[model samples]
Target: MKFGGLQLLLAIALALAAGVLGAIAAGELRDTGQSQTLHHFVHEELDLTDRQKAQLNQLENNFAAERKDMEISLRAANSQLAAAMEDEHEYGPKVVSAIDEVHDRMGDLQKATVRHVFDMRALLDPQQQLRFDRQVASSLTSEPGE
Candidate 1:
């Protein structure tokens, strides 16, 4: 009975760890794909005037810095989560709090990325905006590698 209980607890812990890691991996993959799609659409698909290009360059630079900071914070949150899991060896208050922090960081990064996308879209002309909108919608809706 003791052994069975320990095995069950180990299984549950493994499941929780897998869930957390999977969520993080999926988020990172989606973020990378979205970034690549947008970068390609803006730089290659859309025809931008010199002024628009300059403006976009500046926006990209600023967003890059912000994105880096958010990513760093997210990494830190993940580290905390790992520590909590290791120290507690099971789901506990510390683990729950760390998970929440990770989710919050992910949400912050996602919101900032969406805002940056909108800011870029704003610089486009009507026709460009139409194309950009379609691309953005498609990127968001499509499955990974689709």
Candidate 2:
């Protein structure tokens, strides 16, 4: 996609998630000294019970499906936008419309990501919820790799 800004935003979001998960995993590894994947980190750090793990797994899977569909639509919109921009002869209303479509897709993706985060956070207990909130806040406010 030509929307480098949008791509960067998404990358940052994923990076933040990874960094936070890694940090949590690091703390958990003090006793065992074994490396932890993000999935294991989440379970250990969040103190997720079996039921919660199943629920979170289901939720993640559901969001992944929805996100895949959204991505396909967004990709189509971006392709149209790129084609319109590449039409050397004329810059018409089609270009404007394509730009709008791309922006709309970006907005939709952003909304979906935020909603997914909130949905996941809702599964946590009071203490874990606070930790989740802090992780998100810190990630959003701080630069990548900070």
Candidate 3:
């Protein structure tokens, strides 16, 4: 039960495609879940004052712009990874560097997002903060679709 060269190549291609598609799908699902968690907690669960609402709106606008920039950089890093994978055709130095670059970009985005969440938390009153904290913890710990 040895694979021929063409069959091996086809299997490798299918595996790579599956990996890429899974990553994309997982990212989308995570994004959607995070968005819903934040939206429900901030907009519906908490009783926000007008002033707090205004401040949160400003924070959201600023974070939105920053997130967009980070997402663009992440996409560029992903492109570099793809190019490296294509050119190297193996787990080589360029591919390693590209993977590191992508990870760094992703870390940057995650850090910024966490900071933004804290910034929003800072505006909440004590009671609201309690709920917010719980929501954040739940979102972080819960399984998907929970």
Off by over 4 Å in 1: 1-36
List the candidates ranked by TM-score, beginning with the highest. Answer: 3, 1, 2
lDDT of 1 by residue, 1-146 (tens): 23366655665565456456635543454554344667878988898999999999999999999988988887788778767766676679988998898878878887888899999999999999999999989877887757
Clashes per candidate (backbone, < 3 Å): 0, 0, 0
For each candidate in turn, the TM-score is 0.79, 0.68, 0.79
RMSD of each candidate relative to the true structure: 4.8, 10.5, 5.1
lDDT (Cα atoms) of all candidates against the true structure: 0.77, 0.64, 0.74
Candidate 3 ranges with C-alpha deviation above 4 Å: 1-28, 31-36
lDDT of 3 at 63: 85
Q: Score candidate 3 by lDDT.
A: 0.74
TM-score of 3: 0.79
- Which scores greater on lDDT, model 2 or model 3? 3
Ranking by lDDT: 1, 3, 2
lDDT of 3 by residue, 15-45 (tens): 4553454344224336543447676679887
> What TM-score number comes out for model 1?
0.79
Assess candidate 1 and give its lDDT. Answer: 0.77
Candidate 2 wrong stretches, greater than 4 Å: 1-41, 88-92
